[model samples]
Each structure stands twice: as structure tokens, then as C-alpha cells.
Target: MRANKGLAGLIAGDTAISKVDVSTSSLWYRGYDINELCEKTSFLEVAFLLLCEKLPNLKEFQEFEAFERAHRDIPDSLYELFKTMPSYSHPMDLLNQSVSILGSFDEKNTLGSNSKEENLRKAMRLLAKMPTVVANSYRLSQGLTPVKPNKSLSYSENFLSMITGTETKDPLSVKTFDTSMILYAEHGYNASTFSARVTAATLSDLYSAVSTAIGSLKGPLHGGANEQVMYMLKEIESVERAKDYTLKKINRKEKIMGFGHRLYRTGDSRTAVMKKLGKALATKLNIHIWHDISDIMEATMIEEKNIYPNLDFPAASAYYLLGIPIELYTPIFAASRITGWAAHIIEQHNDNRLIRPSCDYIGPNARTVEPISKR
Candidate 1:
């Protein structure tokens, strides 16, 4: 029997982490609607919900918050490692290497410790330290000094602060970033999450699973779509060119970076929330060009092909308005997705499986091996 290509529509396994209802174009995390979670909670709260299997109560939230803040500092040795690397390296590559290095630092806790309690501890550490690694690695690469994480700020604020090398005081900016994180936090068994789960199913360490996920996310079809979207917008330059540019790409049968998704047909459920937030940021920053260009491009694509913009489409402009570097987009994704990846990793560890899938052997059928001398 022929299997689905890229395992499309294949129910490989079950998950309680998050659900993407493609029919309705809605997403829920642990039974909470993504829109409600964005409006009612913070990214860290969502992280707690994903990992702990429920939303945290007040005391639980406070304790979790404190733990995350406390562990934001990575080793000075990591900084030194970042400094030694060539500046031309991609941030995602640095991030992947950083997680592996971090695994080395916590081998005692990570190795042979797939217990829920231990995995949760490791997960929290990764969630806390990822921002530091992502921001500092990029900073060091740019020949700029790394900014230390400010525990006093909220998770999103501190993340922006570190990336920008200053404390973020704008509430709207912080909220937009937080919402983006929440939206990107989890989606059921996407490529990266599935890869992470596959690694975890082998009983490997949590960091190894996360490293695997990060590498998978570096592709343009995955988390790198956000970065590519930004580049495309920049290439289009202005609103006047947007329609023609989109039509040309469509006519040429080129895959637009952020126009469609494998999961959502009518639309990506996360897009509307992000588009609103992104437009608001555009208005706030007095920079209407990116969104204006995007609006035209979006309309053209829909009218021509019935294709809808995904979350990454608006997110690119949002992050641009927020003053984030384009290349850091996927790494920021990795930083937020560490929560979901860990949750999946922990779940896989709890129900241990080898995750070895069989494939149809379509190579030369019944071919016998012959010695070189005989040939």
C-alpha cells in the first residue's frame, strides 16, 4: 500500500497537548481557545499550561514565573562559545549547537532521567534560558554586547529588551510579542514537533529532542517562513508593486512563502489575531508601509488563488515593526516552541515507544547482491 506523501492526513499518534481544528480554522491549547488565551493570559502562562497539562492557579503561576525568571541566566561558558563561532553562522544553527552544549552541562539530570518531574525541571530550564541564548548569540554575532535578561520584566518584555538591547516600555509592543509567542507556542504534530517527539520516543535527553526540533524548524516551509515573509515584503518594497509581484509569483507557479498552510484550508486560525495586532503595531509605529503592502498582496493572492495568508505572513511585518532582526525570527520561534516541544517530549517519555515506522520498499525489487569480482 502507498503511504501518504509527507505523511499528510495520516494519524500517526494521539496528543492531548493542542488541537488544530482545520474544519473551523480554530486552535486550542489544553482545551482553551487560542484567542481567549491570548487575551486572558501571557505566554509564560500558556507554557505552564502546555507542560503541566493545565493552566496554573495564582500560586502555581507565581512559582512557575519565579522559577523561569530565576533560570534565565546561561553559563558564561556559553557566551564564550558564541564568541568563538564565525559571525556568518545562522542563529538557528547557533541555537541548535547551544542546546546541545546545554545538554552537556546538565547531563546528570538529562541522561537516564525521563521521569516527568525531571523532564519538567529540564523543560523549565530550556524555556528560561532560550531567550538568553537566542538574543546573546545574535548580539555577539553582530559585534554588539549581549544584554542580560531582566527578571523584573514580563517574559515578552524581557525577550524584546534582550533583542533590542534595551528595556521595552511600550505595553502594546510587549502584548503583540506575547501574543505571537502564544500563537506560535504549539500546533499538533507539525514537522518540528513530530521530530522532537520522534527523538524523545527513543528515550534520548530533552535537549537532544529540542535540538532535533530546532534543526527541523530551520527550513523555509516551517518556522523560517516568518523570516522569508519579511524578505519578500522588503523585496516588493511598496504597496504599488505588491499586486504585480504576487501575481507574477503565482503565475510562475512559485510557492509564496507565507500564503498557505498544510493544516488550514479556509484560513490559518492564528492569522486574524496576528494581522489585527500587526496592523495595530503599524499604526502605533506610524509605519503603514509594510502592512499596506501586505494588505494588497493578501487581497491579490486570495482573489487569484483563494489562498489565505498564514500567521507567519502578518508576523513578519509585526516583528519588523517591533525592530526585530529578520534572521532572528526562526530562533525566536524556537525559543517559544521549546515549551511545546518539551511538552511533547515529556509526553513521549511517559509513554515510551521506539517510533520506528516501516516504509514500502520501492527500490529495485528482489535484487540480489553480487560481488565485485563476479560483476
Candidate 2:
């Protein structure tokens, strides 16, 4: 059998969660289109749809929101633990540690005996608390007081408020942030989601599985791409210089972050919605330089290499314009993606199997071990 490096096109297993359709460059959660969700629903509602397989009704949404709000305040010990961690540690690492620590706090943290209800409870707790963990970690690292969640704000607004330590009374910014979250809520078997599933297939508890996913998403090639994209845009510095910089990179055969996606040959469908939001923010905030530079780079890349920007491309500038710190990008991704990761874990547990795949051996035939002393 022919081997596929990175298992590029291999269908390892079935999932009824999300689909990434290459031909259309579309993403869907359950049966709903990503664009529709982004435009029509709040992130809390989208999270409900992802985790529960249907959009929440008024009563159900109220219940979900209440549960989420009630769990928003993480243990004070977690914040103290953050102080002991090195300030220079990547925020993703801190977030992963938080998840592991959260598992320890749960008396029912175990494998196998987790009923659907139990798993849902765990998912809700993580979903509610992850944004707080992310926001507080950043605040502590900056030598600032950690901001508590404001239940008065919506889920997306509360998260932004926690990070900024200001109430996001602005409707537009909150809406844009919520849109980003909905767009990011899920994709079919991305690296991090796959990692979560692999861990779950081993009969691990929900927290362990999610922690595994967070570690995987921390890699630059995955969730970190948006941060890299922002760095790249800043490096370009000017709209006039963007073309030269991008073309030089292309000539050098260097990989450009956020320019292309594996699943979308035409383009990322999420790009349009994000790009629109980015443009609106740039215009309103009068921080048009980043967006203009992005436009130039995007044009140059497509003209030179026919590559289109993924969702991460536009998302970087939008987040920057929103006054977010660059280091917090991937953590934001994690906060949004937690819903998707939880959904996959639940699905994996529903019909569990060990996700073990064999690799072809290309080393010396029948090699024998030698004694250390002989060597």
C-alpha cells in the first residue's frame, strides 16, 4: 500500500459533527452552514448547537447561559497557580495546565463510567471557565489584577471584558468578536480536534482529552497561525512595501502563514465574513494600516501564487484592532474551539475505538539490539 505522509487525504474514521468540504470551501456544524451561524446566532447559541446537536430554544438557552454564568468564576487557587508559573511561558501552556488542574478538582474525573450527563456537565464547566482562565492568565502575566467575568455581558462580550478589564458596552465590537467565535467554533477533524478524539478513544476523561487538544493546537502550524499572520503583517509595515515583501518571500519559496488552507483550493469561505468584519473595524477605529497592508499582501500572494488567505489571515488584524495582545491569539482560538473539541470527545465516547494506525517500517531489516557495554 502506498503511504501518505501526514495522512493528508486519509479518512481515518467517521464523525457526525462538522464537515470541511473542499470543493465548496465550506464548513458546517451539524447541518447548519458556518456563515449562517456566524451571521445569525450568538456564540453561546452556536456553542449550544455544537454541543447539543440542535440550536437551543429560549428556555434552553436561558438554562445554558445560567449554567455558563454560574461557572464563570474559576477557583482562586487557579489564579494563584498562574502566579507561580513563569511569566514567559506561552499562554497556551498555561491554559493546558489549567485544564489538567481542573480535572484534579473534579471528584468524578475518571474514564469509562462517564455517562452522557456527566460528560455534558464537564463540558459545560470547561466551556464556561476556559475564557476566564485565558483572560486571567494574560492579566497575571502582565502584573495586573485578574478581571472577573461580568454576567451582565453576553458570553463573547464577557470574555472580551475580562481580558480588557472594561465593560464592552459597544455593540459592534461585541458582535464582531462573537462572529469570530462562531466562525471558529468547529471544523471537521482539524489537528487539535483529532488529538482530542485520539485521547478520548483511549477512554480518557473529558479534561484529559481537551488538555491533549490544547497542546496540539499550540503548535504554529495549527491554532498559532493567526498570531504568526499578525506578526507577518506587522513586519511588512506598509501597504506599499507589502507587495515587495510578499513577492520576495514567494521567490525564496518560503511558506506564508494564513495565505492558504489545505482543505480549500478555491478559498476559505470564512474569509469573506471575517474580512468584512475586519474592514468594518479598521474603518471605524481608523486603524486602516493593518487592513490595507493585508489587502496588498493578499492581492500579491494570489496574483503571484494563486493562494488565498484562510480565516486566520483576516482574524489577526481584527483581533489586533480590537486591542488584544498578540500572545493571546491562540488562547482565543482555544476558547472558541473548546465547544468543538467537547463535541468530538462526546462523539468519540459514544462509539469508542482505539485510534491506532500502523506505520510502514523503512529501517534496516530485522535489526538486533546491542549491549550498551559492547558499544
TM-score of each: 0.97, 0.97
- Model 1 TM-score, 2 decimals: 0.97
Query: Residue by residue across 266-318, what tens digits does model 2's lDDT show?
Result: 89989999989888988898889998888888888888899999989999999
Which lDDT tens digits does candidate 1 get at residues 141-213?
Answer: 8888999999898888899999999789798999999999999999999999999999998888898899999
- Per-model CA lDDT versus the true structure: 0.92, 0.89
- Cα displacement (angstroms), candidate 2, residue 192, comes to 0.5
Which regions of candidate 1 fall more than 4 Å away from where they truly are? 365-375
Clashing pairs in model 1, backbone N/Cα/C closer than 3 A: none
